[model samples]
Each structure stands twice: as C-alpha cells, then as structure tokens.
Target: MTVPAAPFTPAPMPERVTIYEVGPRDGLQNESAVVPVAVKAEMITRLLDAGLPVIEATSFVHPKWVPQLADAAELMGLLVDRIGDAARRMPVLVPNEKGLDRALDLGLEHVAVFGSATETFAQKNLNRSYDEQFAMFEPTVRRARDAGMDVRGYLSMCFGDPWEGAVPVEQVVRAGVRLLEMGAGQLSLGDTIGVATAGHVQAMVAAFAEAGVGVDRLAMHFHDTYGQALANTHAALQVGVTTFDASAGGLGGCPYAKSATGNLATEDLVWMLRGLGVETGVDLDAVVDTTVFMADALGKSPASAVARALAGA
Candidate 1:
C-alpha cells in the first residue's frame, strides 16, 4: 500500500493568519436585548480598530427568528461612513434569496450563507432537513459570487450536536464539499455544541485533506462550552489550519446548540498566537479594551479571561 503526502506542516509559526470577528453577527444573534443598532456598529468599528481583518456585521434573516439583527440594513448604513477604506472586509449573513437581495441593495459585496453539518440541527434551526437547508445555499452562494462578492459557507455543528449527539467526520466533509462546490470562497467548520476534543479536530482536518479540501480554504469556529475550544484550536493549528472565527469578549452562543458558550475569545487567541510569534495583526490590549467597552455598553462583564486580565480587572 502507498501512503499519501501530508496536506500541511504544523510549524511553530507561519507567515500570517486571518481572524474573522463574528461578534456582531454570530455573537449577538441569540441575545435578548436588541443591543441597539448603533451599539452593534460601534462594536464592529472597535474590532476593526483592534486590527481584526474581516467582521461579519449582521444577518438578513427573518426578524422573527433573530430580532436582535432586525436592523441589518441599519447597521450596514451606519458602517458605510465609519469604516471608510480601511481594508477591513465586513461580510453579512444572508439566509436566502431575499436576504441576499437586501445585502446587495446595501452595496455589501461580501456575504455568507450557513448550512448544518447534522440533519437534526438543521431541522431545528432552519425548520428544514439538511438537504433542504443546503439546497437554499446553492443559489444564494452562486449569486453572491457572481456579484463579485466573496462567499463564505458555514457548516454548523461540525463536531457534535445537541439533539443528535456526536457528528461523524464524514458528514462534515460532505457538507463542506457541497458548499465549496457551490462557489463558497471559504468554508467554516463550526463546533456549535463545543463538545469537540483536540483529537476530533485533528481527524476532521485530515479527513478534509483526504477528500481534497485545501487547508487554506478552511476556517475553524469553536465554542468554549466544555473549555476545549483553545485546545481544539491548538490541534487545528498543528494540522496547518490558520483562518479562524473569534468573538471580541468571548461573547457569542448558538441558540441551536444548547449550553454552548461564546466563541473562542479574540483576546485569548491573540495572546496564544502572538506568544508563538504567529502574526494575526491583532492588538491584544486593544481587543481587551474593546471587550471592556462592550461589557460596559451591554451592562455585563468581559467573558474572556485574557480580556479581563489584560484590562487589569
């Protein structure tokens, strides 16, 4: 039998990596408070000030589903004058054809669509089976790409599921392939339930590589519910994973994934990456300050340990 070559090298440091700040979109989607559209825009501005490259600004989903993001167009209008030519890309989430149309009307060129890695999660979140939800993404993704927008596809519950329990690695790979084939410029494997281990991270990356998915086109979005997020992220780095989605104060949760927490905090990941000499272009202190600002505006405390520590809280 012949062995295959490795897809990537787990080096101590690579040239650089891109971090997508999803606090405004994924982070606040489940929040009860409307968070005020002005506040949402400011949070995104602050993250960009902290050198975050790409920020998912808002989602054009039905207001009934996520009322907090009801002002998607309002938020984009606010961002237009504030984020002026800074080179920071803000991608809004579009759930269907109508959502994409709304995004295009705002002159938003970058867009993202989400589908589930599990059938059960899909049925609950989108009120449709996996195939149905993903079928919706096909035209949505293509239209975005055709409009010269960068298309990102998110495969939620990649590692485990609240309703169905452990998700198979093959299921994730297949969903990813479908999305990539649909013209998604990048694919994110989301650990929505936050039950994944570092071992699962390694295996999943290898499986995608085996299926011919390039590591460069992949991004990991891990939740810290079980405190395995950073560890799982470390394992992903060892497999040559680079791009990742993070929230400013560890402030996000999946309404679909029961008990899961916010994303792997941007401050924490910045600390780790900077300590290892990997360039993420993020200012750890700035991120901490931004989190503090977020906490004050939301009447809450910063969720990231690094943010609190660096803020001297």
Candidate 2:
C-alpha cells in the first residue's frame, strides 16, 4: 500500500551550525600565483581573529601537483607559533603517510585526509585507484586519531565526476562511510566538479542518512559553476546537515571540471544563515574586511556580491 504524503512543510531553523573556513586551502589551491608563507599565515590570523573555529591552513600534496602550497611545513610552523591554545583549529591536509609524518612532527592538533568519490578523481588527483588511495591514507588517519587529533574527511566530486559524468549515489556513500569509519569526525561532501543540482544534493544527503550516517557528521562544499551552489546548500540543509564550508570571497574552482567554478560566497551564506537565525559565530564585517584583503592578494575583485557591497567601492 502507498503511504499518503503529508503536506509540504518549511524547515525549522537550525539550532547551531559549524562553518569551516577553507579559504587558505581550497581557495588558494588552484591559483596560479604562489602565495608566500608569510602572507598565508597572515591571512589565517585574520580569519581566526574573525572567530572562524576551524580553518584549513594548507595542503601537503606534492609540489608537482600543487606548487602553490609548497610551503606547508613553513605554514604549519607559523601556525603553531601564532595559534596557541584557543578555540580555533588550523588543520593541514595530508596526502599520504609521508605528509602525515611531516604534520605530526609539527605537533598539529587536527589533520584532514582527502579522498574522492570517483575512481576518476582518485586516479587523476592522487594517481591511484580508489581502493589504493584509501589504503595509502588509512594509516595516516589512524595515527591522527591515536594522537587525539580532530580528523576531517573530504570526499571530492561528491555530486558529479568530470570523467565519469554523474557519480552513482553508491559511490559517494561508500566513500563517505569508509572515511567515517576510518576516524573522520566530519565528512565534507565536495561538489568538486561543481555540476551538482539541488535535486542531486537532496538525493545524496538522503542516501547517506538512510545508510545510517549521522547528519551532524556531514558537511556540504559546493561550487558555483552553474550558479547552483547556494541552491544545493539549501537542499542539504533542509535534510538536517548543519555544517558547511565556504571560501571568504568564493575563491576556488575545479582544476578538473571544465565548467565548474568558484565556491558559494561566504559573505552571502553568512548573511542568509544569520537572517534565518543560525549562530555561526562569524563576524560579517570582519569577514568582509578579510575578503577585501583576499581580493587584494588575488589581484581581482571578490566573487561575493555581499562582500563587494559591504566594501562600498
């Protein structure tokens, strides 16, 4: 027998939310310009001063792949010196056991392991099969967990895969579940190719939930390629996921997805969420100032309309 559906209802305002600032990592990963370690450290200080809790400081991928972040060790050193015991966290990305060892030597309190939702992205980004890639980082995750560190899981291309087109829901769920079981405190679902729609977002979130994954353990990372990031985010939020990542000025893009573009503007997300009464603990005006600083660093205007308006240029 078919169950009758209740009338549609508006989503209740979220009680609390986590905003992980990814400006230093995702925002700068694709930039052609090589940002100095000092500059990156300063930007991070500015972000923490604005009260963002968890800021992704940098990635430790091979310089061949992301020459922009070659200063990962230096960046980590600077962070430890500047960020004493505080509510803020600056987790660095580790591509393998080597990267993990390097970060552990620096005594980091948090670290992240990156995995992709598709074989194509896994092979393309890390030059390994999905299984092989996960195997490579498994030890890294274990070490971080044993050290009492907060570990985050990132599943790239969660919505769509450039080489494979739409990724099956099973593919993403398998990847997400693996990471969660591997000791990831939060699983950040990345729209790596930036081709996801609201409908797609709804399906993926539902599948993960139905699979018995906790919504609090999930986060959404969207790209505005088709200008659908905010819409996709709204869809995920409607399903009870509370955490979302944003670049201050929408400062990122897919190196793999041709039509994929920048992140949904942090300023815009903050405005909308705050208006909805969500407590993000971020200062909108400070975020605008930092966006302007980031714009100056990028040598272009910020992608955020809200940031631009606040600057009053």
Candidate 3:
C-alpha cells in the first residue's frame, strides 16, 4: 500500500524548494552515543543519493562542548576522499574564528555561524549578551567571506525562548538583519523550542520582509515539539520561503534547549510538498530507508511519524 499525500493544489508555494538536510551535524550532534566517523560519512553519501541538495556535514565546535562531533576533521576527510566534488556542496557549523579556521583547513566551501535572537539564550548558548554576540560573529563571517566561502547564519530562538516566554518580532528582525549585513548569504530562522504556530510564523516572516530582508535571503528551521512544525512550515511556504532546514527522520533537537524536540522530518516535509506540487528533488522512499538505517544505528526507532509509518509499511 503506497499511500502518497494525494496530489492537490494548495496555497501558492515555491516551484522548487531547497531542503537543507542537517541530520549529520545538528541531528547526530545530540546523540548520546558517538557515531563512528565512517558511519557519519556514509550517512552524508546516502542523503546525497536521496537527492538532498545541501547537507550540513559536521561542526568544528570544540570536542569539549560537543563530543559527538569530535571526529569532524576525520569525517570531512573521509567524505572528501570518498565523494570528491560532491563533498564541496556540504556545509559545516563553525562557532567562532577557531572553528572557522578548522573548517578552512579542510577546504570546505560553505560554513555557518550560529547566533541567538534573545538575550537570555545568547548568554546561555553563546556565552555573550544579545548585542555582544554579533561582535564575536563579525570576524568569523568576515574571514569566511574573505576566503570566498559561502556563509549561512543561524539565528536561534527566533519564535520563542525557554528563559524568555515569547520573543518579540522586532528583536528577531533586528538580529537577523545584522547577520545579513555581516555578509551571511542566507539566514536560517530557528524556532528553537518548537513553540511557534502558523500565525506566529507568518507574522515573523512578514516582519523580516518589512525589515528589508526578502524571502530569498531567509530559511526556516522548526522543531516538532508542539506538533506545529509542518503547520508552521506551510505558513512559511505560503509567504514565499523556499529554503527549509529539516532533519532526516526528525533526528535532532537543540542540545542547549532541553525543552526542544526533534526537527521537522524530511520525509514528512517532502510528502506535503509532493502533494502541493512543489518540487524538492527528494525521493521520499529513499529518505525513509535512510532513516530506518540510522534508527538502527542509534539503537532506537525513528522519531518521525511518516518515517515510522512508511518504513513499517
């Protein structure tokens, strides 16, 4: 029984959407068990085979902070040697100048810097105040741009924060614009706690648009904590957002935000887009199989509803 999402025209959606697969870095980083470098490499290759255009490979953050990705250099080396030019399209998260240096040494063409929208989250996540965090990111973004590497900026806690109940739209817009001004090619707005609803998502995207940042320069990263990830994604799509950050099989949550849960599942997003007649270039069946393989590697079942149902079927 191969049940599809039943193709139908919905609200205006982008003709082609770019799915930024973050399972390898953001997904595997929170795993309690450290996945072997070879296994991690294989996951990237599998994701590429499944037609994901942009896959975040690994992070160069210190091993002390994120032990799960301690094998960042090794993993990237294996991926480059195994996949050749395809590896160039993969981006890695770099927390600061030091991390950026590590990523540069590997000749990675794309890198992302993580920032926070609220003050409390900034202190807790980046060890800097909300305004001060930009000073830290300026040099890293500048240097990465200097190296001719494509830079993506990740703004966490855009919708709401654990310490701060609801984030102001103006505050989020301000911080996001700063990142864009600092030379970030694309800014990923993160609903770190999964507290966003469809209306809130539309309002936030609209606020950014009013701030002179178009949908062309923004991406949406949502978590499924309140079961609104897909709904929120739909809202973003209706507003002309074409890039979405999704994890394979809903593999990751924010390690810093304990209340956060798994991200929007790639299989689920692809199904909705398929029904809406939007092209993601993803094979849903291949993504489900990859999730099953990774779920077994993690010694647990996948958290994605679509993956569980489709894999079981």
Candidate 4:
C-alpha cells in the first residue's frame, strides 16, 4: 500500500488581524423577530468587553426595510454614555442621505454605506440601478467625511449573486474603486450569498490589488452558507488582508438572498486565528461567553461550532 500523502501547506499569513465585529448591526438586522433595545445594548457592551475594537453598532435603515432594527436611535441613546470613554470604534450603517442625517443627528462618529457590485442585486436591494446607487453614495460619503465621521463602504455580492451568479472579478473591482474614490476611507467586500471559494477569494483580492485598492484599506465579509467562510478567511489572510467582518453567535443572513446564511462567527474566527498564532487582541473565552448569552436571548443555541463545544464542556 502507498503511504498517505503529506498534509497540504497553506500560504503565508499576516501576524495580526483586526476582527471588525458586525453582530449588533448586520448580525441582528435579518432577524424576523424584533430584539429589544436593552438586549441589543447589552450585546454591544458584551462584545466591547470581549475586546472587539471595531463594532458595527446598528443600521439607520428605514423600519419598513428592517423593522427588527427600528430601535436603532433608542439603542444608540442607551449606549452613547458607555461608549464615550471606551477605547472602541462604533460604526453604524447609513443607507442614504436620509440615513446619514439620522446618524449624524445622534453625534455618531463612524458610519458605513452599502453598495452592490451586480446590477440585479443593486436594483433589488437598494431600489436603484448600479450607477444610480453610486450617485446616492457619493453625496452620503462626502457629507459623512465632511462631518468628521469615518466612512466605510460595503460592496455586496462581490463573488457570486443569487440571481446573476458568478460575479466577474472585474465587476467587483470597478465598484470597489468607485467607492474608494467617492471618499470611503475603508471598503468591505462582501460574499453576499456565501458562494465564494478559497480560489475565488485569492483571485478577487489580487484583482482588487491590481486595480489599485490596497489590502490595508479593504476588509473581507463572508457568510457561511456553503461552509466556506473560515476557509475564505484563511485565503484572504494569506493575501495580507488584516481586517475581517464576523458576527457573534454566527447571527444574521441576507434577507434578499434566500440561500445566504449566518455570517462567519467571531468566536470561530478567533479560535482559528489563535490556533494559527495570529493576534486578534480579542479574548476568545469572553467572546464565547458573550455569544452564549446572546444565544439565550435569541432562544437558540449559538450557530458557532466553537461556542457549542465550549458550552458543552
């Protein structure tokens, strides 16, 4: 009999990573049942306590679009005092000029604008064509920057679209460049339907780099629909991407894309990163505890394998 082949080797990875926790906003936005403001505030506090430096606090989207997050303003009011002295960054999602106005009114310091790479998703999600969406984003990004708030842009469906299927690498690069040129300080490329493979991840990052977008100014946002988020994260790490987006308890999915599942779990990412000797500055045990608490509130076990194993132990 032939001897077993040697284990596969991974590419080089960064020493440290910035885990951009999006549980409070992207994680909870897709919930059909409304989460109370007090619970939401507690989740944010718990995540901060777990040492997540950058937390996406909430979305200022209209209630008609995301009724689950209708208490965004109230939630912010409750946490404003606690967040003031903390050494953490809280960014809220603002869909348009109106959304930006609401966030600015609350004296928020960081905000994120969302765009779609494919025309089908753009029209379906934002009710605007691809170009029209950028037109809306320009004014919002400029105004947010002028107000001294750091602006982050999210480019959705970067890899594959449920309707369009297999989004072109060039298409994603073009949309990302426009967002950067429009004054977004950072851009998060999203695998909206969780259809991206490790090879796709590597090529997409390379394509963006070739198009003049530095890895430092970019972040990867993956969903685990096909169970590839962690693998995709590994691929991205090899390409020198230091920032990643994850949700606690693996919460949230894309409402528009039925196949989309929960985002990559922060606990899972932390576990993998720790095993690789990567520095995330986040306490993994604390994150597990936080997700357990959130799972209790949501009346279900956490979707994270790491959290589930630790809880059982």
Please name the candidate that would achieve the greatest TM-score relative to the true structure.
3
Candidate 1: which stretches are off by over 4 Å? 1-11, 85-88
* 10 residues in a row with least lDDT, candidate 4: 1-10
- CA-lDDT, candidates in order: 0.84, 0.82, 0.91, 0.89
Candidate 3 residues 162-262, lDDT tens each? Answer: 99898899999999999999999999999998999999999988898888999999999999999999999899999999999999989898778899888
User: Candidate 1: deviation at residue 229, Å?
Assistant: 1.1
Rank all candidate structures by their TM-score, best first, as comma-separated numbers.
Answer: 3, 4, 1, 2
Give the Cα error of residue 87 in candidate 1, in Å.
8.9
lDDT of 4 by residue, 191-228 (tens): 98898999999999899889888899999999999999
* Model 1 TM-score (2 dp): 0.94
Highest-lDDT candidate:
3
- Estimate TM-scores for all models: 0.94, 0.93, 0.98, 0.95
- What ranges in model 3 sit over 4 Å off? none
Predict model 1's lDDT versus the native: 0.84
Model 1 scores worst on lDDT over the 10 consecutive residues at: 1-10
- Candidate 4's C-alpha runs over 4 A off are 1-11, 85-88
User: Which lDDT tens digits does candidate 1 get at residues 51-144?
Assistant: 8988888899999888889888878887887765442257888889999999888777788988998888888888988899878888888788
Output the lDDT of residue 272, model 3.
87
Clashing pairs in 1: 252-262
Residue 301 in candidate 4 has what lDDT? Answer: 79
Better of 2 and 4 by lDDT: 4
Error in Å for residue 38 of model 4: 0.4
